[model samples]
Target: MENFNAQFVISFLIIALGYCLKKWNILKEKDGEAMARLIFNVTLPSLIIVTFHSITIDSSLMMLVVLGFVYGIIVAILGLFIFRKEERRNKGMLGMLIPGFNIGLFAYPLVQGIWGEVGIKYFGMFDIGNAIITFGVSYLIGSYYAKEDVVLNFKHVAGKMGRSIPLMTYVIIFIINLTGLSLPGTVIDITSVISKANMPLSLLLLGIYLNFSFQKSYWKGIGRVLGIRYGVGLFFGLLGFFLLPVDDMFRYTVLIALILPMATSVLPYSVEFKYNQRFVGTAANLSILISFVLLWVIGNMIV
Candidate 1:
């Protein structure tokens, strides 16, 4: 219990430090994008490689990936249905925010602190499918429903996924694991050093990017979005807890992930789709704060 609280406190504090730095003009928002690049391109991929390299591969492990993809689609569909009454512009943003988990940047560090590399492996596998939806499926939805006529170019989405280092790393590592091969010790050692930076860098970048501004008009949309998000969260979270065939650690991981914040990608999607940035930004911020509290409660219960 002490370990969980301590890790949560330290993680939140680092985020607070980044927020303070940004507010103080010590770190600009653009700097957060640079840190994000560092995390996604270098550290996160390294972490995935190192974690997958160390774990034995099994057919059952595929369940983790399947769970991610299936649940994401489910939640996304649910969000679309629940908010069907909203205006066209709001639908895209609402749907975009619903499905993807902020696993790499938000959930993994806390999971690692609580459950170590094994937890990472579970969440890492889950992240593979989450990445697919984030970059591919969710991107399509956002673009498709944009108030502006968006030329649906799947090639563009595919190009974005192709450019993703972490997703590619997942594929490469999975292939290697399939061959019953492990990475060279020296390679793992080198990546270990780089991968270690992922947690703090990710959380700190999230802090730097945090925004809370919102107009009065945004609250109606924001309220409906949050309501649907946690509504789905509560239902599936309980189902996973009581019904999943997985072991305790995987169950616990899934439960925590259920309540994670809206993906940071939502902000950019709002811009791309000509959705309300104020609403999206406000929802994103509130999700972070709300997810933190939910995660703390769940972490204590399960830890």
Candidate 2:
């Protein structure tokens, strides 16, 4: 394989293996939940610690934080406007889905493989703002529109964001790097071993979670979600790539970040806020497939 075809090939093969495991009854889809837990708690944090430990922060990279945040907020507002005629519950469900990207599980693997630690560091900056909206603003949107009377406030959102292991890891490592401090060498050695599993585990998790079934009822809403998600993603991805004077990696990060799968939290939000679970799951799956294909095209173009 030339260029990124190597990583993509390995990724697809692992994902297929995972799906086959599920199909063969060796690993159930629910098994993915346990895998997800491990990834978030251990492997992901380890990757963050090891990757960010020695990388220098570019002042310009901070702009990714802003773009990640601003784009999420804008897409969210657009969702509401587009679905203004939708029911409160449906509107909130769809609106919340628009804003967030699946950076930790989806973006990190491809980036780590293609651009190595340098790209991971840049995407990490972008994810900080993405994390805020994923945990905070999206929660607010879902709760605000739920039929149940739920109290909404900034404190609640902050608490949620504070509890994110990956986000917390990012903040701590970023701060430590800023202060010119290093993690203890022993800690680095342990984390290095654990972090090696992050990418393969993430790719496998995606495959295990895949469901090829889609309902006839879902196409209408799913179409709306995907059409806007990619349509707007294309606009921003192109604009950022062409107009921004940033380095190629930063621009590429922006393009891919905007175009990634919807946030994993959207499914939980559906369950929590009493939206249609089937619809949310199907739409999210479709996004993953579409993003995979788009990334291939984008990768081939840039490489």
Top candidate when judged by lDDT against the true structure: 2
All candidates: TM-score: 0.94, 0.97
lDDT of 1 by residue, 273-295 (tens): 77877777788888888898888
* lDDT, candidate 1, at 103: 84
Q: lDDT tens digits, residues 170-246, model 2? A: 89998999999988999999999999999999999999998999999989898999999999999999899999998
Model 1 global lDDT (CA atoms, 0 to 1) = 0.83
- Model 2 weakest 10-residue run by lDDT: 147-156
Which residue pairs collide, candidate 1?
Answer: none
Backbone clashes for every candidate come to: 0, 0
